[model samples]
Target: MSNAPSSPTGPVNRLAETTSPYLRQHAHNPVDWWPWCEEALALARETDRPILLSIGYSACHWCHVMAHESFEDPGTAELMNRLFVNIKVDREERPDLDKIYQTAHQLLAQRPGGWPLTVFLMPDDQKPFFAGTYFPREPRHGLPAFKQLMQGVERAYREQKTAIESQNESLMAALAELEPHASDALPERSAIDAALQQLDTSFDPEHGGFGDAPKFPHPTNLDLLLRHATDAPQTGAPDRSALAKAVWTLERMVRGGLTDQLGGGFYRYSVDALWMIPHFEKMLYDNGPLLALCCDAFAVTEDPVFRDAAVMTADWVLREMQSPEGGYWSSLDADSEGEEGKFYVWDREEIRALLAPAEYAPFAAVYRLDRPANCEGRWHLHGYRTPEAVAVDLGLEPARVQALLAAARATLYVARERRVRPGRDEKVLTAWNALMIKGLARAARTFDRPDYLESAEQALAFIRGTLWREGRLLATYKDGTAHLNAYLDDYANLLDALLELLQTRWSRADLDFALALAEVLLDQFEDPIGGGFWFTGRDHETLIHRTKPLGDEAIPSGNGVAALALERLGHLVGEPRYLAAAERTLKLAAESIRRMPYAHATLLFALDEWLDPPETLVIRAGDERLDAWRREAQRGYRPRRFVLGIPADESHLPGTLAAMAPGERPRIYRCSGTRCEPPTESLADVVKPTS
Candidate 1:
């Protein structure tokens, strides 16, 4: 699967010179595609033609469908080239444009928007007047044909210019209205309770997810749930009831088709509520958060299932996603061999011949192979029954059944490897790699896996070495080029990841990297007047609109993560400026958080820390108990706690960490908010609340 369009004989367009794999995927399209650059925008204005902008990522299935059905067709491509300046953008590479246009599409269509997003913009202002997604080559499914739609759009642009201009005015106003307005105070704890209540209302008791069919992993929501469950009563035990919903959901996901049974990563999402059929694309962003969530879930419940899921996911990333250059790749495409799920689905005879009767019987019984085909008339593996249940049916021991299934899976995986693999988008994205680094570091600390920590450090080193330059960061890198001004997510996420990595293994260089990112975030991305962070940097290219978003989407909110990271770093280094910035961000989003707290899970996380600042534990020890002390302090899940253990001989520490010099014996300094308890050797006293 080259991911090239069907029209392969045409001369390459401007996309041929770009680094984005998504844009390059359309290089051979008959549609004279132009990369979204100043040159393309200028050409549209010079010709006085509308700009047809299509935004999507490499792994999106419908993006491929639209490209194949319309962009590849000669007649359709000719119309697109003649009528408008066809500009293509990879959403991953240029999320600022995608965010603005997607919001416009939602407002225009009165529904949610998705890729491949189609918009017609006035070239002079670049304001979209018409928008849609995935129109067919010929009229079907209530959508007008792409050719007819373009002609109509062109006629409107020429004849009804005034009406379009009027609509654009209203659209711009609506987009501005969507930005959060600053409030005087921080959000109250009632908002957190309300969010949990809301989750409970929408939670599917039968299926263990939030909503009906087409369930996403929603890692942020799960993380909030897990933290809520474990934030105990200082001395008493935690409320175990809150853990049930998140644990139930996580267990079902691990056993479902959403997880790769033979492989070791999760697909994009499940197409059904039962989690039995997935969309079948693996993304680094999704897995990173999910990996950390699994580790936390294991810590809270001591469940082996979560630990296993974390191990498998980490192994998959190490084996498949990590590049030789040390940065993690963005995503794996959903389609292979020109068809969806062609690489993962299996026929009945293929499985029967691969395994012995004992292995085949247990595998078939547990993985729904004995039942009718579940996906595209072939089996996509899902845990139809537990091994214990399958063992009873097969008249075998549970341990023996597990051994047989493991052997069967190994054989099947080897056979599957011989097939053509899906196309991998090899571009290294800073925001996404930071997310994976955070997950890997958390997993390493929780599971005591040095290898995981090393992998995380390598990715961080790649970013520091390649992306970070001259007190700033680059958004993405591929081949030998790293360009595009870094966005808020890049700076905020990497800073947060650096904090996590420091907890695993403190590095002076990493600490310096974290401090630099924090400074860049406050200097370049923060909206001083408005009191929150903008999605784009100050030096970013001018666009139709500049956005400051507070809600969580596919990933955590950048503003939310920024506030959290800045606040944590402030406590660590005694920087009141960083602390003040975080406080202002919370106040800025106060009203929005109250109105829709569920959508602002990341912000709620920051708010939780704000309402009651985290307990900071500084350990200065010379003995081997340093590792043991750190681990024991973090034994149970405490979301409002930070622990850092420095060696006895380490020197030149910053802020409060520097003041706490090593004593004759192991000593701990506990700080809550502005107050600090005297140095104590007892771990129990440090773990308890200071009165």
Candidate 2:
């Protein structure tokens, strides 16, 4: 069985005994790959053959161009090692084997395919029929060549094996059916006014993102269009607004090129639809939900351009994806030198050979770069020019032409940090470091920034001293170990980043490690008789489908953000079993939120907190004037609400909270459920009842 010459020539069996550096970067390829378990599906059902698989990740740039053109050639690894039984997996460590091979390559490429996918299957039980992605080892770009598409899928699995298993069992039974709903359920304010009339029929109001040309930043459909424009006049629908088209598509995606205006996050999408060019991968879960949608558009329009794009995406996640044992590094590479927007496109004569020619036409007319048509001819993006078009081309004073294009974009972000950058993927993960510790502790209480709350307490002390362990919660670290198996979106996004760092550092050991990892995510990813939350973990090693992770793809649904972090840790600790496991995981996706309510906008922000449950702002005494009155009560636009800060020797305040006793220099305690109020020691008495 050792065959020894299984292609890319030698070593790497059992993915060199795992711990995935993308399955040890296909440990010496030569095609006899394997690594997707059950002993590679019992050696492809004992050599009846046809498995193949593939999938990808490890900062996928065409999964390193189909692993350096045809899994490192050697005659396309001896015709994929004498026809199929390959395997390989790593879609970020089995996102349920990349959701059943990307739903069988969108039902065999009916359209929709990405990554280095590939596919094929059949080995008696593995299933899939055929899929596709990168091909070309000879036949030019129009596709079809990996050795005549592996000798015509090994002569149609040895002469049309039952018409390719009856066309992949009728396309996996028409993709496991499921749609049919309408027995009239609506009311949740007519299913949020038919999801704001399907976001005003996929709003793109002349370029600001919704649909049209590859754009992405859905940020949970701009957080369900700012919670249905602040819950539409208490549901009577006063002038149906979708929060001014979700703040003009988040201020034109922070002035386009899908944001990265000289570094400071964003860009996992925007292949043109006015967000201009992009596809330059940045990720860490798209800068923790675009820095919590630029701190909820700077708390509903205090918009200093969404507070300087949420303080330059929390200072580019503390200067380039944090982690010096602080945690946060998952992605960056959208190819660096090997092309793809090579260190972020430039051209216009390399900004006229780095400025001077009298500051290259006012830094190329304040960034829209005078001419070179969008990308390809270079100058990818830089739109919102006005500061009176950089004060009529830098004669100055539109706030000094916006402080000289912010000091020439800080000297071209220090000469694009001396070039060759990209390639980060250091991999920490635990659900993208609990979504950048709840977007750097909610952008350090809105934005006062004690260095974004000490970079969210050194990423919650490097996810409680290196990805916790033994008592579980590991999910992925890298180099210094902490291998896989953690999913359920890494314990519901690290217990909602330790309940938003115990609501701004109240830290009774970060609310006892977010109530002991929310009872280890209700004893390992719940779903008792199917409710929700099962991206694997009922004693691990189980497959052939246990999935359950609701919807929302590019982030959201670790069972809809663990049912809104168990309804805000069951109102911060008065746990009714964390609000009955967030009402039985939103009644098992109440019919996939009435058939795709914009792919469950964070389960409609936890079903608008089980239908209206916000308003809880208890701040006791953690000082810096109760941290500047809890950063001016999180700068407004409440969205229901919950803001506990308790710290004068903490004594109970989490059984659905309601206790506040400090008042000599640090106070403020507003509540909702278990009601309570009166206790304010200024920050203008806690913004005099919500301003």
Candidate 3:
């Protein structure tokens, strides 16, 4: 009867001493677990036991499943305790550790899987030899049981340790070769053309998204495609029809169930290719990029659908996700009431009961709820009538029908809120909040909504005051305390947010802070030898390998954001070093960029910088008319454009850029390099090319 919850069948260990919710959840497990630290590694080295590393986030469904089925089971845990130095890591707090190990798993599995990542490593050096995801308690689903797998791995480590170590060494060597490189042989322009053509062919013209089942937002890719559609090429012939189709597809996404009709934000992704029947989880990162994309789409088409979707997403973040202190929450779980889509799915009878008899039929018809349920014996609501369809159904004008739907949807949202909502993971991640802040700030300026700007400012203040210490940012904050060293994403995204805020509000402090953080990012995260940025800061816990992640994931790659940050810093601070760093990173990642341009959206933006440098628009005065012109310019689909708003009364610009003359009339100066265009007073003239 040890206090460690040993079932008389398993060994006892020190993970029982910690209070990290993730660790505490495993404290009573029969497995002897060790919290990651120098002590754990030393124990592994001393015992000659291969370290069994289990990494996952608290809200991950599969993580919970593994804990229940294996970690908590006395028999399975006993075998694990006897064989390995079990270590648990919360990937949310230590994304650096997760990145390296997850990359190793990807190499081993040859395909990606998520949650409860189990990696087995050598004792002394912590070099991973084997990696896989969750395993069941007993053999099921054609997969080996946890006990059998652990015994096999333990036997291999004990009997064939040398061979296992040699294999791991080879794996690491192969992983090192995965880095992207700039090659003279790469057909860069042609690759981009091919990617665009592939997109055109792959595009679901009948619907709005790309490819087949399990459609993702891929907002970055869509944004890039939209740019190609709108911006007339400097050399090649313009494809106006392709641009129109792109715009049409984007509009469809806005109107489809991919967008939350009753709620204001998007679900993680659509399970189907038609942008209907979304997976129930809602991630902060997905919403951020989607919000920005929606804002841009609204700017191009001035389509009300795009505008409403953007506003709704911003509103959702502000209402549901925003922390009391101002930063946004991480995500909403996919499951509630013991089922994945329970909170979101509805029964036909339940819908009928909730609405008046007459109202129910019309509402059901409007939402396409009269059809057989999409989910097994349940209706997963989707695909509300289009404007034309709604017009026909309501026997009214299209505009009037749209207005009515909007008003009715607001009422339904309130009713939906009354139901049991999915649990929110309220940990405020600095990188994600930074992305959302930038998205909201950009949306605010584009939509002329001061509230969105205010939300962004408040979140920035919270991050600066609460999550920042001694000029360095903390990665996560919860319950009034910040923990974990800030990653490169935090610095890069925060810098991007500051730049966006500067454009929105012309805040000098924001500009100065952004410049300083950009410098810190270069100094701390930059790989001077490798020519890219590492995810972990220089002072954070060192791993067996430092990975420079450039591949796109749920969020844009840190390297992509870092490149964008460096380019913006260069433009803002008038320093070639920042630009040079960005160029080097892009060059280093050129091979991957050329091969998978769709995956490297932010990098494409960086490439656009080299191909056609961002136009610096300096406005010396702030008149409402001038603000409108500046906002319009920002709203337009100009990927290679930067705006610096300097009030005429300010003594100097923060960067090396020169200040404009003080004058009564507001002026716009468009500069590319050392040369500046003649100052123009006409708003129409400034916005003419934007249309």
Q: Backbone collision count in every prediction?
A: 0, 9, 0
- Candidate 1 lDDT by residue in tens digits, 1-691: 3355455665887788999989988988888999888888999999999999999998999999999998888888889989999999999999999999999999999999999999999999899999999999889899999889999999999999999999989999999998889888888977887888888889988778898988999999988888887774432565465678899998899988989988888899999999989999999999999999999888887887789889999999999999999999999888998899899999999999999998999898888786889997999999978889999988899889989988998999999999999989999999999999999999999899999998998898899889988888999999989989999999999999998887776577888888888989989988887799999988888898999889999999999999999989998888888988998899899999888889999998888887788998888888898888888877666678888887788888777668888888899998876668889988887776422
Q: lDDT tens string, model 2, 395-459?
A: 66676656656777777778878888767767677887788788888777777577988987887
Q: Where is model 3 more than 4 Å wrong at Cα?
A: 1-30, 182-187, 235-238, 241-245, 248-252, 622-629, 678-685
- Candidates' lDDT values, in order? 0.89, 0.73, 0.76
Query: Model 3 misses residue 182 by how many Å?
Result: 5.1
In model 2, what lDDT does residue 567 have?
A: 78
Top model number, lDDT: 1
Give the better candidate number (2 or 3) by lDDT. 3
In model 2, the clashing pairs are: 7-30, 8-30, 557-560, 573-654, 573-655, 574-654, 574-655, 574-656, 614-640
TM per candidate: 0.97, 0.36, 0.92
lDDT per residue for candidate 3 within 474-561, as digits (tens), equals 9988766687889988998888888878888787788778888988888998877657788888898878787778767878888888
Q: Which RMSD values do the candidates have, in order?
A: 1.9, 21.2, 3.8
Error of 1 at 654 (Å): 2.1
lDDT of 2 at 594: 72
Candidate 1 Cα misplacement greater than 4 A, ranges:
7-10, 232-237, 688-691
